[model samples]
Structure formats: C-alpha cells, structure tokens
Target chain A: MKVKPLADRVLIEPNPAEEKTAGGLFIPDTAKEKPLAGKVIAVGPGTSDVKMEVKVGDQVLYGKYAGTEITIDGKDLLIMKQGDILAII
Target chain B: MKVKPLADRVLIEPNPAEEKTAGGLFIPDTAKEKPLAGKVIAVGPGTSDVKMEVKVGDQVLYGKYAGTEITIDGKDLLIMKQGDILAII
Candidate 1:
C-alpha cells in the first residue's frame, strides 16, 4: 500500500542512523540517535494558502522527533506536514 | 539581544506546556509533552528560490524536536527553517 499526505503534508522514508563514524567505532542501537534525514516519497497538493515546496525524491532533513510513524507493506514510513521538514540536503 | 532569522528561517517563542487540563488535574513536568505551538517572533527574507510563507506574529505549530535551541537576553527561543513549522494555528 502507498501513503499519501494531505494539504502541506509529506510522506517520507527515513534513512537509517549511521552505526559507525568515520573513525570506525561501532555504535549500538541504544546509543543511536533518531535519524533526521529522509527521502521524500510523496507530497501533498498544499492548501489554498500554502504552496508545496518539496517534491517526490527530494532528500530532506526533518526534526528528530517529527511525524507520525506508520507501517506500510512492512516498511516503516513517516507522514508529516511540510513544516516538520528542516531543509533539503 | 534581538534575533533575526536568515533565509527562510524563523524565530519562535514556544508556549509553555499546559500544567492543568480542562478537568483541572495537574500534570507534572516529567509527564508533560514538549510544546509544539509558538508565536512567531521574527521571519527571514527568503532566498530567491523560495518564498517565505510565515510572517512575524503568526501563531504556528512545529515539530516537537525541530529547531536549534538558543537563549537570547535570557529568553529561550527556537531558530528554525520555515519547513519546520507544521501549520499556522
């Protein structure tokens, strides 16, 4: 199943948190911070007042705890309003 | 010190979390959810590529973990990009 956002909202697929730094020390899951970057999967048409700024396939950075989590076709995804996004990376 | 956001960014002053609910029960700080609503204190001159949507004085909702926290002149504030805002409430 596919997810679609509504009115200034977006659907994103989160990137996994890095388990190792450039120095190559492994980090465990408990020590891992929530990921803040993702790939845009879908975008809303935006309300009459707000215009959509992101498009599908855009790599975005979002708030660490943003969005409602959902499971679609056994895949974890996030549905959030555009405002939860910080920047296109 | 006064804060001025840059390039599609915004400055927000968060509303305090509600300590009492409509039923008059008190909520402890440990149980309180992070405030997601705020009053826009300032706005950035958006980059040429992106137009600004929010203005100063607008009430907005943002992601709970959005923005960088900073203190200016003893006041706590959040500096974030326009995309971190979820809606104008």
Candidate 2:
C-alpha cells in the first residue's frame, strides 16, 4: 500500500538498529531511547515556502522527538513534516 | 529558559503519562511504546502559505509518529511543524 502525506509531511519507515552491543543490546521496543533513523518512502509538497530537499529514496535522520507513528498495511511508519527532518544521508 | 521553533515548527514539552495500569506498568523509558501527548510552549510563524491554527498554550495531540526531541534548559522538548499536530486540545 502507498502512504502519502499532505503539505510538507513525510512518510517514513524506521530503519531498525543493525547491531547489538556487548553490554547487552538495547532494543527500541524495550529501550528508553527513541529511534532516530529511517528511510523516506513518500514526501509531501514542499512547505509552501521552503522547498524540500529530500526525495522518496533518501535515507534521513530525524530528531528523536520528531514525527508521529502510524501503522499502514501493518507496517509501522512515521508521518512528519519536512521541517522536522534534521538531515539527509 | 525558553525554546522556540522556526517556521511552522513547534516546541512542546511532553506530558508524561499520568497513570500506569496493568498486570504491571509499562514505562516509556522502558516500554517499546512511544509517548504522544504534550503541551505547546512555543510555536513558529505559520507556514508561509498556510496560517497555523495552533498557538502557544494550546494542549495538543500529535501523531505518535511526529516531532523531534531536543533538550533545552535541561528539559526535553519536541520540535515539529504545525502540520504534524493531529489535533489541538
């Protein structure tokens, strides 16, 4: 299924942490830390004034406090406005 | 101290869960669940094209997927654009 956001909002699929540390890994589903990385699956039209710099295939980093979580097609995804995006990778 | 967001962005201080119920309680700092409620402390100028409907002092409900987290004056704040706000309370 395709998810689209309106006016600067973005649809992101969080990238799960790739590694576990020796101290014993902290799982986001279990850890106090919020997840901060994801892949952009869809993006809204620019914020009306500021043009967005990310595209659908971009990998980005967002603030830990940014974005709203939603489940689409049973897949967890985040819906955040472009301005909340901190950086693109 | 105060934190101000830029251009349609909002600064919010999360309202911690008011109650915990269960066979046991789940702490956000421990649970896989994300925190979603907060009070608006500061708001940016509305998006250039769309005037924001929210203002500082509004109690809001955001998508569980929105906003970025930042610490200012030793307090945690979420930074998000107005569009990420799901509803105003």
Candidate 3:
C-alpha cells in the first residue's frame, strides 16, 4: 500500500534497530537526548509558508514522541509533521 | 512585559480556571476530547507560506501537550505554534 501524507505531514520508517551505528544515527537507549532516527518514506507538499525541506529516502532525526505510529504492509511506520524532524542525518 | 512570538508561534495564557464557566469553555475534567483552552497573548510574524490567523486576545483551543510552559512576570504561559491551536473558541 502506498501512503501519501497531507500538508506538512511526513511518513517515516523508524530505524530503531540502528543502535549499533555510531555515525550519528538513532541512539534509542540513552537517558538524555533520545531523538529517534528514521528514513523518510514520503513527504507532504508542505504548507504555503513552510517549504518541504526533507525528501523521500532522507535519513532524519526526530523527537522522541513526535509522530503517530501505524503499521503498513506489516511494517511499522510513523506519520508526523516536517516540523517534528530535527535534522537530516 | 511584552512577548512577541515569531514565525507562526503564539503566546497563550492558559485559562485552566475556565473550568468553572458554562459557555462552552474549558472543561478541565473531561478525559475524552480534552483540548486546553486559552487566550492568545502574542502573535508571530508568520513565515512566508503560512499567514498568521490568530491574533492577540483571541480565545483558542489547543492540544493537551502543545507548547513549552513558561513563566513571565510571575505568570505561567505557553509558547506554541499557531498550528498547535485546534480552533478559535
């Protein structure tokens, strides 16, 4: 199934299993600074004011509790606003 | 003290005590549909694509955990994006 986000929303595939990478990927187990890492699966056209900065396949960092979780095609995914994304890694 | 929000951000004065009012005001006791009500104290200039729709003194509703809690002049306030606001009440 193809998912399309609307108006600044983004569809992300979380990389929770990337804990072993040290190239500034997701650091899930830390007590402080627990930003989640994910790959952008899809991006919305963005609002008139906020231009879309992220593109699909972009590796990004987001807040710990930034998005809503959903299961698509038996895979877990996250849907959030582009604002929830902190940076592209 | 004057607060000027920037880029679609709104400074809101939370009316938690409005639970006592009966005119479709904040019902702080409800578990479902618990949108917090507040008054806009400051408005941002807005980004290029998004226009500022909320003005200072506009009564609005927002999410449960929308903005960062702040204290100014001994008063508690919230600073959030205008998008966090659900509606103008």
Candidate 4:
C-alpha cells in the first residue's frame, strides 16, 4: 500500500544505522547512534505559508528522534512534518 | 559575549523541561522529554538559496535533537542551522 502525507507532512525511508566504522570494524547495535538521515518517499502539498522544499527521492538529514515510525507492506517508514526535516543532502 | 550566527543559523533559548505533571506530581529528570520548543535569540542572514523565515524573538518548535547545546554566562542555549527549525509558533 502507498502512504500519503497530509499538509506539511512527509514520508521517509530511514537509512540504516551504521553497522561498522570507517575502519570496517564491526560495531555492536548498542553502540550505534540513531540514524539521522533518510530518503524522502513522498511529500505533502504544503500549507500556503510553508511551501514544500523537499521532493520525492531527495536524501535528507533530520533530528535523531523526529518522526513517527511505521511498517507498511513490511517496509519500515517514518512519517514526519516538513519542519522535522533538517536539510536535503 | 553576544552571538551572531553564520548564514542560516539561529541561537535559541530552549523552554525548560516539564518539572510537574498536570496533576501536580513531581516528575524526575530521567522521565522528562527533551524540549522541542524555544525562543529565538538571534538569526543569521540566510544564504541566497535558503532565505531565513524565522526572526529573533519568534517562538518556534524544532526537532528534539536538532541543535548543539552550549552554556554562556550560565545560560543554556542551542545553536542550530535554519534547517533544524521546524516552525514558528
């Protein structure tokens, strides 16, 4: 099923937490930091005052605990407001 | 010292954590959630591509983990990029 967001909301697929460091040493789950980046899957139309700046397929960084998590058709997703997004990278 | 942010940056004074519940029960620090709102103390002249919409003295809500924390003159503050801010309230 496809997910659509209401005004000023966005749907994202978060990047996985780092499993290893740059040196390729494996890192334990408990030592991993929360992922703060994701790919935009869908975007809302936006309210008149807050125009949408991100689009589908855009990679973005956000607050570590910004969005609500959900699973749809076995895919993990995050639904957040446009304001929760930090930057399009 | 006064703070002046670089392009698209903002300085904020976060709202205090909730210390008591509506029922007047004291809540411990561990149980308190991070403050997601603040008062803008300064704003940067935005980059040409991303115009700043928030102004000094505006009340805003931001992603809970959006900024870097610092203490100046014994006052705790947060410094964040414009992208980290969610909305003016």
Best model number under DockQ: 2
The alpha-carbon deviation from the true structure for residue A60 of candidate 4, after best TM-score superposition, in angstroms, is 0.4
lDDT per residue as tens, model 3, A1-89: 99999999999998866541333433344233445567999999988857777789987666668899999999999999987775554
Cα shift from native, residue A15, model 3 (Å): 0.9
User: lDDT by residue for model 2 over B1-89, one digit each (tens)?
Assistant: 76667888888878865611211343345323432557889988875566666677776656555788898888878899877775443
Tell the DockQ for candidate 2.
Answer: 0.06
Better of 1 and 3 by DockQ: 1
Best by lDDT: 3
Looking only at chain A, give the TM-score of model 2 against the true structure. Answer: 0.76
- For residues B1-89, write the lDDT of model 4, one tens digit per residue: 56555447688898776521222554665854533778998886676568999998998888767776544445767778888888897
Each candidate's chain A: what TM-score? Answer: 0.78, 0.76, 0.83, 0.79
lDDT, residue A68, model 4: 94
Model 1: CAPRI class: incorrect
Worst 10 residues of 2 chain A by lDDT: A19-28
How far residue A62's Cα lies from its native spot in candidate 4, in Å, is: 0.8
CAPRI level of candidate 4: incorrect
In model 3, where do residues sit more than 4 Å from their true spots? A20-32, B1-89
Model 2 per-residue lDDT tens digits across residues A1-89: 45445566778888875611323655567655443778998876665576878999898878667776654555656777788888897
The runs of at least 3 residues in candidate 1 whose Cα sits more than 4 Å from the true structure, single-residue gaps closed, are A19-35, B1-7, B10-66, B69-89
Interface RMSD of 3: 10.9
lDDT of candidate 1 over B22-84, digit per residue (tens): 225545658545337888998866765678998889998887677765444556567788887
Which TM-score value belongs to model 3?
Answer: 0.46
lDDT of 4 by residue, A1-80 (tens): 98889898999998776521212333443332322667899999887655677789987656667889989999999999
Interface root-mean-square deviation (Å) of every model: 9.5, 7.3, 10.9, 10.3
lDDT of candidate 3 over B1-89, digit per residue (tens)? 56555456788898966552535655558576666789998886777767899988899988867876544455767778888999998
